[model samples]
Target: MRNAEVARQLGVPPGTVSYWLHLDRSRRGECPGRRPPPPCPRCDDTPLDEAAYAYLLGLYLGDGHIIQHSRHRVPSLMITCSEKWPGLIDEAERAMRAVFPQNRTCRVRKTGALNVKVYSKHLWCLFPQHGEGRKHERHIALEPWQQAIVDRYPWGFIRGLIHSDGCRTTNWTTRIVAGERKRYEYPRYFFTNKSDDIRRLLTDTLDKVGVEWRVTRRGNDPYNVSVARREAVALMDRFIGPKL
Candidate 1:
């Protein structure tokens, strides 16, 4: 289908209809002599380690992209982390290496950010989460084995979610104490994501850890999960920690 046809059918802009059409051209019964390309040299057959993979999967769902390489390109995995938290990027690199030790990992510089990228065809295992438009437009759920991994290392999963889509910071508000006006500050953790499934996963995991969180909307935007209050934040502090 053409870009304009897709845009009209899906009620989306033309630019949003990128790559799919371009890539599908190869699979549209194009030529009688065409053959599947040889396997990628960078691809690996590494076994999955549940705990580490759960953490990496959480990070991928939040900030990673598994690019499907074109006929002339190589498949690659990319995870973007904030430049402010070098540790988060380092852990991300570590997770990728742990998952795919045979592959080489590198960093790409983006404005105010750095991306951990690896060229490996094996990264296609994450294709389930890849889609058109944005994550909010797509539904994300864990596979049975992936969910089992998360069940064991829920905290690690939470860490990745908060590290990628959530933040820890101080929130201040003015209130009245004993009939007198006063101001106070508190440490809180806020997580925002367009995916309802991701939010539910975070909340369910938090519930398991006995850390309380609240859900609200920021204007007309996506759901915001708040781990405020001293008690709740304390629990998060012990388990989630800072992005670093």
Candidate 2:
């Protein structure tokens, strides 16, 4: 049966089915396209054929939590394999179609990082802009560590540079340690107050990477890319000492 039909029968979103199918793909030695056969749902451990597996993956890709926003629903397909498997992606696509004939718009992209592939669609939202003269909302107070990142890294590296009206909270602390998962948000301490924790983390990571940086508080305006670039060059000169 197609993914939608299976999802309707199962009383779940098509995307959820897709996620399970994807997980099943990982369990098997095969990439995505080479599904075994549909096992009995009652049995749980029964193998799945290519058609059955594709339907499940379609359900997952459609309903997975990987994307933050719910309005933008797009399916994706990723395939990895050993040897020069140039046909793997194609085979997977065909198999998926056998289950969900309606899913023709999902996008797939290949990355050079190992044998990984990513399938996703963009989600768009409408939000306000932040700048002078605009009514600004107070962002969450930054922890010491987050502040450190802002003080150390150049502004250009920070992702979310624009200001916008919204809620703020301490939950953002994770960004400094790992980084933001979303596309628009800054690294850490962009809108929030500076913290010592951020500074130490920034310094440590930069040190490990062999990049030298400095902190300067010129004004309330956070790190600006052009200004930071100029400052970085000067800092490098100071570090190496005057050239003889």
In candidate 1, stretches whose alpha carbon ends up further than 4 angstroms from where it belongs are: 1-46, 71-73
Model 1, residue pairs in steric clash: none
Per-prediction tally of clashes: 0, 34
Kindly list the per-residue Cα lDDT of model 1 for residues 124-209, writing each as its tens digit. 55445666667878788776756777889998899888888889988789998899989888899999888998898889888987
Measured against the true structure, the TM-scores of the candidates, in listed sequence, are 0.76, 0.21
Where does model 2 exceed 4 Å of error?
Answer: 1-67, 72-201, 221-244
Task: List all candidate RMSDs to the true structure.
Answer: 10.7, 19.6
Q: After TM-score superposition, what is the CA distance of residue 142 in candidate 1 from its true location, in Å?
A: 0.7
Compared with the true structure, what per-residue lDDT tens digits does model 2 show for residues 1-244? Answer: 8889989999999999988887777678466565443333223433323333322232222121132236644423333322333343344445444433433423344463112223233211101111123112322233353334334432311211211100112222222335645433222111222433323333444455345455545396432122123344444334322111
Q: Quick one: best TM-score, which candidate?
A: 1
Report the backbone clash tally of model 2. Answer: 34
Model 1, position 189: C-alpha lDDT score? 96
Model 1, residue 101: C-alpha shift (Å) = 1.3
Indicate the residue-level lDDT of 140 in model 1. 80
**Candidate maximizing lDDT:** 1
